[model samples]
Target: MAAKAALPPHSPGIATGAGWARLRPRGGGAMRGYRYEALDGARALAAQVVLVSHGLGMAFFPVHSPGAAAAEWFGRLAVMVFFSLSGFVIATSLSRLVASDGSRFGVPYAVHRIARIWPPLVLAILVTFAVGWLGQNGLPLLTKTGDAYRLDAVAFLRGITLTFAPGDATFVIDRALWSLRQEVYLYAIAALAALAFAGRGARRVLAGGAVVGLVILTADRFFYLQSLALFAAGAAAAHFGGRERLRALARAPWLGPATLCLLGAPLLFVVRPGFIDAMSDGAGFLAYQAALGIPVALCLLGLAIGDGPAARAAARWSWAAAFSYTLYVIHVPVMTLVFSLRAHLDLAPGLAGTVATLLLALLGAEAVSCAAALVVERPALFRRILFRLLAATGLARPAVQAAPSI
Candidate 1:
């Protein structure tokens, strides 16, 4: 519990080179400090979006129900947002590693990533199992079944490796492990992208080509590419953006409204003609998603371009933002259990168990996630172990220089 409580907020700041070096080049002096607070706030917002979407689904529809056209469309869009957010955060974090190490090819680089992601995930699985046990044994929450066989320790060990073969969807604890696998792949690709591109134009060209290939392949195999594309955009921004230009763009009059329009159009058109065609299958789906990328990318770009009131507010709460990863890890199980209990409550129809379940799941996941962060995730000691495994798995490289002093 203490581990969870002491967890740091989510602040994805500029990655200075290793060991207290300056972020700018040796002669580039007196630049503005990187905003850690704003980055953390962005992470918090992304996590909240995911939580809210999950809450809506669990409360309003069966896990598989498509709902009305509008509902179905929104659900799919919510998932797109999730993928895009993952890309942004991953790219940002990887940039930090690259800046810190001066190379993306060593042990410490990979270790940092594993330490950042796995602790909360492991805790989530353990806690979720506990919840499942309680629900199944008639301790508190009602469950869907009594005979579901909890996977054995061996199965869990296998999942920890995340090497499940194709067509294998079995995850004993955290069903979300599949997404994590995709995330790992994207990180690797991004690292390679950093290593491969020696010039800005080449990086852009390569990334553009990759995005096109991804659209054509559409193999669920390359679902990670979708995230990779968004990540590439951020990476490109980092590589190309200058402080003066970012500041100038921040003042653009129409940026805010245009961003809103792009994001809002899909929601507004949920019931309109060709809406399903746009949101659903085939070329329409591709076009709709590409359009969505516009807003998602702009929102992130806005963060860099301006330090407006919204950005300032986000920075203010950055310290409290650390629990997003923990919350993400635990929320699914908490919500699953909550949804399973609906039948037992005898609630009237249209009362969508959503509100109550959301309130409880939010509160519960937060409390528990915080505890895990403090006790399990935050210890500086376990970081050693986490890094070693990730390095062993070829996930990252070592730092080439001391990290830049903040």
Candidate 2:
């Protein structure tokens, strides 16, 4: 457990927080930081939270609704963790890419990006359409013959593009895909951020901090912007500090606990039915936005400092991390189907079923996502292309290269 909590050995091709260090090699070849397995484990935990949240929704509709809502409010913290971790992980990788060869960030990065994101996403979309088709019993859109298309072409395209410009119903592959749209935006923002911070020394850190603060203050409307800030923070921590700093902090420990408290603070304002209902729709939206940022920062800090048994357990589970993204993409529709089965079976929708169903759904999503990763997602060439195109288009950073493993 202690070994698990300790930071993974640094390596090349991963992102960095510090802009000061330049690679050096004994044999005239440059050295690089390696992937940290522990972080991946942390990501898997976040994905599970998202899964549990969706599962609760399934169980809530039929049984006790109030508890479900409470679970969702707390569980939804995973979104913040996802955003922050995205920033941290991406920033870390981008920093390393710049350190290696800033211009090398072309085709290869795109392939990595596509490989990491698209396959699972596409499969999830297929699952949605397939299930809708099956459930509709041949009726288009799952409605009567004369009724409107349920998973119509327009909705599918809108979701694929994630433009959300149409103001249509927010259903597609999964309701959670809204976060994917935001994630795309964050990817762009993180790239630009990486470019801005590729230089060495104090200015890079200050600029990074300023960018994060700027995004935090101004990115209220678009959740993607907030995610960029969180990623920036992670990138900053990785580049600036080392394992020693993390270990030293763990010795003291309060920082992690305190950050958790801060993360949980805003929830108090809006978690209650009265509070949620009391606020105007706009106010509630604002409150939720605030929660994502603070909590993300807190969670990242906890991962850094809390090397206790629980944190160690998370690190051990890090190998399961690659599937987090895929699991996240597919879990919702999977849950919808699973719960639909529960309904058909006349299973009691009590807490037990809800808990059991959540666990089973997670296991199922993990098994399927692992297969997707091994099959469609693991192809390195495609991801590199996607990352490069995103960089060239100024959608992300030209310096941020994609990792083959990702």
Candidate 3:
């Protein structure tokens, strides 16, 4: 997610020599009247929390294991938060781009999206391959399954392409990537909106229509439709969140706490008998995810405008937010490695083993994430070295201007 102030001072649109000017609000629209500033810290903090929950679920609390139901529930909630936040951030960024540059924002928006998502994704694929190779070579990292560590070139290609259909057996590799596929679709939808809709009102209509369409057509495909709905919820927020009424609601002291309670309440059901079973039933899982999205969207709105102490604290740790994506994509493979080691270590199966394993996984994931950030996520240094290599080989000449810093 792009991090910048949630609200910044409003400025009139600027013409960029092209037909379109910057994306400024037209007429007396609700978005035009509201100011925005950077909300990077909050966005990052939320993402990090999701990563932590996912890590805990994988490392300390496998769902099939006894006493792990709560962890599994927490992981599910964290994913809901992630999808909601993804929608919000993408919508917010697109709104800002449109307001600043009008139609001309399309190319830059696409470039920014590509830059933000692809680098870490490439690194993740490589990491997944390495981990799979290890597991195949007598590493006890993964559970023995027909597909586990069976490195068919075709399967590897499918993984990197992220082309598996929702129910395809090949989709299991790096299960977290499923959300990334949804995100890509959302990005395309957002891009289409940018290209086709000239006004904020029109874009809002598009977003609303998407929610309705997805609900009508794919509701039974909960994983797909729910994400689209959440994205639409975020887009709606971007379009109308600035209205005086909504702003007031956002600032209401009860809003933040209420949203938290709504999000947390589902966890209580994790320990209840038949809760998981109910969710597993046809349509039941879909309904649960849809219901869960309501509060997730509300939480996004609260964070968008909230100035609570918690929000402020989250904002302060923006660096963590920067690493959030890498942490997320890398954690699963790292956890697999941890699990493999645990098997050999003959670790006890109680709280002590769980805690120890959790710590190890967390630390390993963080280390890999940090390295990825330095090498792949922020590639300026790598680019510089590449430039030097090219120059050495007489393949290119140095420009008078130093390469613009990222």
Candidate 4:
């Protein structure tokens, strides 16, 4: 038993005050002020690991080599973790907002989400475009898709807003923005659902209609639905005492070691016949990714609730986690640019050249991402100043803090 994880904390209680209903499992998984440091480490670790993966080989190395294969697998696993963790973070943050200010959905939610994804994204796009146009590749507007971007206006708008910008299913400036596009739509659908679940009447009806419309619009799109299922699984785990359940399942000590293989094996068996082909097809790839998320959710649930050594150990990663998103969105352009300019350097060919480029790219990307994260992601002073300015000007409302930094 995890003490009091009685109800699922996924959603917020509608009523306020002392009489508010429980949102966790039957008195088993009570939250202790939303402190999950392990997730911070996990989130940053995922991004950094993927960055390392790309740094090792930006799809330029031999695909079938053992090192490349292992790198790719780790990349897949990290992405799976990233999605589930993101979902958990977003849901928990929303629940926290509702608990504090009592709005089902409002400015804080919209602002936090928008502010989190957009500023850095726009900056990344601009940075990518500038580096491509001025530093190197001065290609025409509609050049064929490759490393650097020709800056498709439609793609940029699509990446910024989930609007129907034709020719935006993929991002030219930064290929990393594709999954981000999926995440934006996921945020939209989830937000609408929260609105519908809030107080009743015409408002709820409109929210429901919006959700239906969103579903219909995004149904056939790439991994949209499957990713939602994975995200909701994370949300469910957070709200529904997944930690308590994890403890129950981990009653036997052996269960802990088994969990690693539990997560790793599914991809080996299910998506074997070329991961690329599976990824292009809608259901199977994301479905496998969703399946992969199961154990990740469990692992996250355990870490979020447990007081064991491994869970607490992740606290070290909290620092890196703070800027993980910045690292993720910008690393691609930063990396691709360095890689493209490799021929200019007087480095050795073969192993030495690859190693040199990887080191330079990785080092540069990390430095830039860290600096960007400081300014954009967690400028505590900046955020405080903004809040005070808003409050003074009468625009400030709920003090809805973001999800404890990353």
* Segments of candidate 1 deviating more than 4 angstroms: 1-32, 62-104, 131-150, 163-178, 198-222, 243-247, 269-281, 342-354, 379-381, 384-406
Which of 1 and 3 is the better model by TM-score? 3
- Prediction 4 TM-score vs. true: 0.80
Can you give the TM-score per candidate against the true fold?
0.70, 0.70, 0.76, 0.80
Top candidate on lDDT is: 4
Model 1 scores worst on lDDT over the 10 consecutive residues at 1-10
lDDT of 4 by residue, 1-406 (tens): 0010112223332233321233434544444434467777777777888888766657354554555555666766676676677676666665555555553446556655655676677667766666556443442222124434334676556555634243342355366666677777767776776666653677678988999998888878776676676677676666664355545653335545776776566445433445544554646556766676666666777777666776778756866766788888888778777766665454457877778778888999999988987777644444455556666777775354442221
Reference-based lDDT, each prediction? 0.52, 0.55, 0.59, 0.61
Report the error of model 2 at residue 371, Å: 3.5
Candidate 2 accuracy as TM-score: 0.70
Give candidate 1's error at residue 315 in angstroms.
Answer: 2.4
Candidate 3: residue 217 lDDT (0-100): 68
Model 4 residue runs over 4 Å out of place are 1-25, 59-70, 134-149, 152-159, 162-170, 250-256, 266-273, 344-346, 379-406
Model 4, residue 237: C-alpha shift (Å):
1.2
What's the count of clashing pairs in each model shown? 27, 37, 23, 21
lDDT of 3 by residue, 1-406 (tens): 3221133334222223322233332333434432322245655565566556666666555455434666555555666666666666666566556655565455445545555676787778778777777766776565323254345676666666667543332354466677777777677776666555544566557655764564566555537776776666766665566566765666677766777786667666666666555544437565667666655555556555666675566557755655777777767777767867787677758778878888887788888898777766754444455556656776534641132222
* Least accurate 10 contiguous residues by lDDT in model 3: 11-20
Better of 3 and 4 by lDDT: 4
